[model samples]
Target chain A: MNHPWTGPRLARVALLLAVAVFGPAAGPRSGFETMSPELRAMQQDDLANPGMLHVAEGEAQFQQQGCTACHSAEAMQGVAARYPAFDAARDGPIDLAGRIAQCREERQGRAPLPREGKEMLALSVFVAHQSRGLPLTPNPDPRMEFVRRQGEALFRERRGQLNLSCGQCHDDNAGRRLAGSLIPEGHANGYPLYRLEWQGLGSLQRRLRNCMVGVRSEPFAPGAAEYIALEAFLAERARGLVVETPAVRP
Target chain B: MARTLLRVPGTAQRGEVVEIRTLIQHPMETGFRPGADGTVQPRDIIRRFTCLYNNRPVFEADLHPAIAANPYLTFTFVARESGVLAFIWEGDNGFSQTETRALTVA
Candidate 1:
């Protein structure tokens, strides 16, 4: 008679058991928590935070575009927390940036803002700023399930010359040193943030693309479905983490 | 137009020291860096910042490319009287911005 349990299967079972017994090793930690005190102080101080400059620019752009005609900035509160939402027109998930572009094209009868452009970054940053301190609340639509699943698969799938997946570093080796910097859990709670490396405000997609480049992988185009899906999954993963739009990071 | 943020106390007691903070949006691109096209980027930075209270110079700074983008500065001055505080920043590429705030001393 053959034994049913193989060595690999037994190891997998043991790992699962350990996970179940101990729960996750740590609770979700924001990149903000991992930042140096100086950077943290920069993020906390509106006068010092460079991201506030983008927020100011965005506010002016919103008013110039007559966004106030439809709704006030206060009305946008909590909006950013529920992004990567299902779009009926696209029949897919759309991130906050995409929604803004769509509204510009359809609602305003104007050309959509260019991805990663100064205007777009400013607008998105401004919109996201309104949701600061609010917990991320990803859309719960059943339609989003498929997108979220795709995002999860892409996140775990190994690719690139480095032969590493996002989860391999962010999930399995978080808090470990990579080069001179600590590997963060890769949450998307604070986005359209100011990065000292970039010396400017950048969107979450830009950050993801940078990671792909670091791994020597071909990055998807801006506004790609893969990115939107990934953003949806990240929004879900980052649920309960407060939005820290325009956050400062080294 | 470049954006600037100014933080000056709206009110202070006479002879009390008050802090004034300012932040300006600028790339402050050092000439040493190469662009995406493999071309050397020209140096651009805020070269000077001046603060005047009641038309009298109170503080001044000469910035350089070594300074980071979005330059921020904070300084304190004794409150003397109700007056306007003017901030002026001059930089490369003919960049210049002026902002003013009113302060009241009781």
Candidate 2:
């Protein structure tokens, strides 16, 4: 029998290790992969996962608000993938939360929901859940070009007392350790995820707020244009990645 | 409003053991933590969780602040016949939620 780790095999193993260490680092992997085994198991098991609770509540609200009277739940599928979509009526881009708020005000004749509130988070989770496994593809209309540009600027611009840009931590130094936590690639594929830090489900805006606070910068309001733009920017960066809404994160 | 998720096998063979899992949404806040005002928040957590199968007690747990938010619990029971499993969780400030799942045996 031939020895597997001698001569040519030894050289191949050395080359593989070198590439693994010096590779481009960025990948389409979900932040869920960085979680502990117990946390991963909780997310894999729907019955044991808390995020599903929010999904359930969101489903209930969708019906209670009479949304089902016109739009079938099935029709809502793939709808979230197109979010942060350009709204000609508003003459600007809007995310899933923004679009839902619009429907509440114009169609349902109801007041807009408070941003990041339980109802809003639940509704977002419920809608995003339907798009699970579908690749995200933000709208690319001409009107949205400026907004995406602003989003890109916001992501790369340095701000706050710490003077750190999002790209520095999430894009350049991802997979590295910081404050005992692994800095993920900061993808928005998993919004409204159940975070151990929050001990509950939260929206992408909520996570952005946390980052803002971390950098010691004043957080933008829930529906602020800045957050909306940043969300769009993140969505564009995560394009082609499968939606992982209601995910569990440590 | 509280949301609950329950997992139970759709069918099981007689005399076989089956797994049951459940999770519920709750803050499970520990009073030791300070609030936005920097004041110590009062402890609030789920106090008890109980499961009944066929109207008979199957499992029970006394939870504390140490339990994570959205308390989760799992257990197994032998399959004897078709029946309903009831889960009840009671906590601080009169918080309570109940859910039921069906089990069938062949």
Candidate 3:
């Protein structure tokens, strides 16, 4: 229901406004060339000065609980902009939670948390806030087009023994709830989202797989082509929705 | 009221880890609290469960009050062991429900 602005001229105008606001007045490292030294430092101060009420919990868990050894707030900044990315290394796309869990498994020398759990939710929410107000950006890898098309087809297609496609419930009934929980519009944007019921967080794939079960259909494999296509379709739909990974949702 | 699922982890190795999750529609009332008045509500809930792999017991568990209503349970097995995962839920008043899913490990 939110009208968004998109166009080259608008973007150009905004860029000029940004330059004027930051240039000369802010002095030294004002332009994009001298970016990090002063610009980043200023933004970081503004970003860190006032934090979300919920982020405190995750920060506590990360720093005091030793999660900082693996990830830091600064490192996660703008990270949500590039999620649901095609990882040729794994030969597929992985959601933010999966990436977090991957590091927890291989690099941090720790056990991975369950796909959706409070631990992951708090962490994901905390991490996503770092990229607040950033633009939604998804990779437009050429090789992924095939999968993206498939997912889009599936979204609009009805399936399952129950004869329901994801779009029927999600797009048609965006603001309704199923049992007791309020249903989100169900955008894949900001996934690896934090859900209150699970008291946890997980990737978009995990939620999609669960929906398949609810609809009496077999879920695709964890990293299957079916899911990648689905991811592509969702990301395209969520374009310009802003990056709010780790956003809190009931 | 019995719900059954065929949980094949993947297609490659019938020896791969496969899980079948089942949930039954039961109030699963853990009778202890009073009913309408101060009268004690009789406990009537699913008391026992057994899962059979091709007609043999491969998994089993006892139910308690701590379990949520309409219980869901998942059983995992090594793949290539093609069989049927049948679930049986029985309660205090002889209330029972049964369902099954045909599974191919390979």
Top lDDT prediction, candidate number = 1
C-alpha lDDT of candidate 2 relative to the true structure: 0.82
Q: Show model 3 residue runs off by greater than 4 Å.
A: A1-54, A64-71, A169-185, A190-210, A220-229, A245-250, B1-106
Model 1 score (lDDT): 0.87
lDDT of 2 by residue, B1-106 (tens): 6777777788899999988888888889987899999999988899999999898988999998778998888899898988988899999999888888888889
Candidate structures ordered by DockQ, highest first: 2, 1, 3
lDDT, residue A71, model 3: 68
Residue-level lDDT tens digits of model 3 in A98-165:
66677677777788786556566556667766776566666678766666677789998887899998
Residue B84 Cα positional deviation in candidate 2, in Å, after optimal superposition: 3.2
**Chain A fold similarity by TM-score, each prediction:** 0.89, 0.88, 0.61
Candidate 1 chain A TM-score vs. reference chain A:
0.89
| Backbone clash numbers for all candidates listed | 0, 1, 11
What alpha-carbon RMSD in Å does predicted model 3 have with respect to the real structure? 22.1
- Model 1 DockQ vs. reference: 0.70
Chain A TM-score from candidate 2: 0.88
lDDT of 3 at B33: 67
Q: Model 3 chain B: which ten-residue window has the lowest total lDDT?
A: B1-10
Quote model 3's TM-score: 0.47
| Fraction of the true interface contacts (Cα pairs closer than 8 Å across chains) found in each model | 0.86, 1.00, 0.00
